[model samples]
Target: MSQETEPEPSPGPKQENGPTTTGSFLCLHTSPPLHIALHGMSALTHTRLSRTAFDLCLELLEAGVKPQALADIVVHILEFKEQFN
Candidate 1:
């Protein structure tokens, strides 16, 4: 059986003059499991949970899991919760 691979995120245009303004910034793609996890947590009314989720994604990346896998994990979690709860 062949394992599916996630597509690489496109690197948007580089800014010649350095960082662009925050409002104009685009997050075209993110690592999967972690990204999905963070996005789900972001819906909560609690600020701490949201921040923690973001931090978790960063830590996962540091640990060397592919971003797409992290996103997929997040998606899996959310789906599991929906089915069970």
Candidate 2:
């Protein structure tokens, strides 16, 4: 019997400047990014979460996770919340 395996997802088309396109900059900054919102919590919590979120953002960007993709995921989560709540 042959085993079937799922293919790894592609990161869309190649941009001239890699994944850090102008659109990505806008998506990550023009609107308050998730890490920025972490400031609303208590000072201690904010410091920890913000630092962690910032590190995760750097890791994601390094891993080729586009800012627009992150934005899309946030939208999907919001939609899910709206539908359920």
Indicate which candidate wins on lDDT: 1
Q: Measured by TM-score, how close is model 2 to the native structure?
A: 0.31
After superposing candidate 1, which stretches have Cα over 4 Å from the reference? 1-49
lDDT to native, each model: 0.59, 0.54
Model number with the top TM-score? 1
Candidate 1 matches the true fold with a TM-score of: 0.39
| Candidate 1 local lDDT, 1-85, one digit each (tens) | 9999999999999755432222333231334564566566666633333456666765666666677898788778767777997
Q: How many Å off is the CA of 6 in candidate 2?
A: 58
TM-scores of the candidates in the order shown: 0.39, 0.31
Evaluate residue 51 in candidate 1 and report its C-alpha lDDT on the 0 to 100 scale. 57
Q: RMSD (Cα, Å) of candidate 2?
A: 16.1
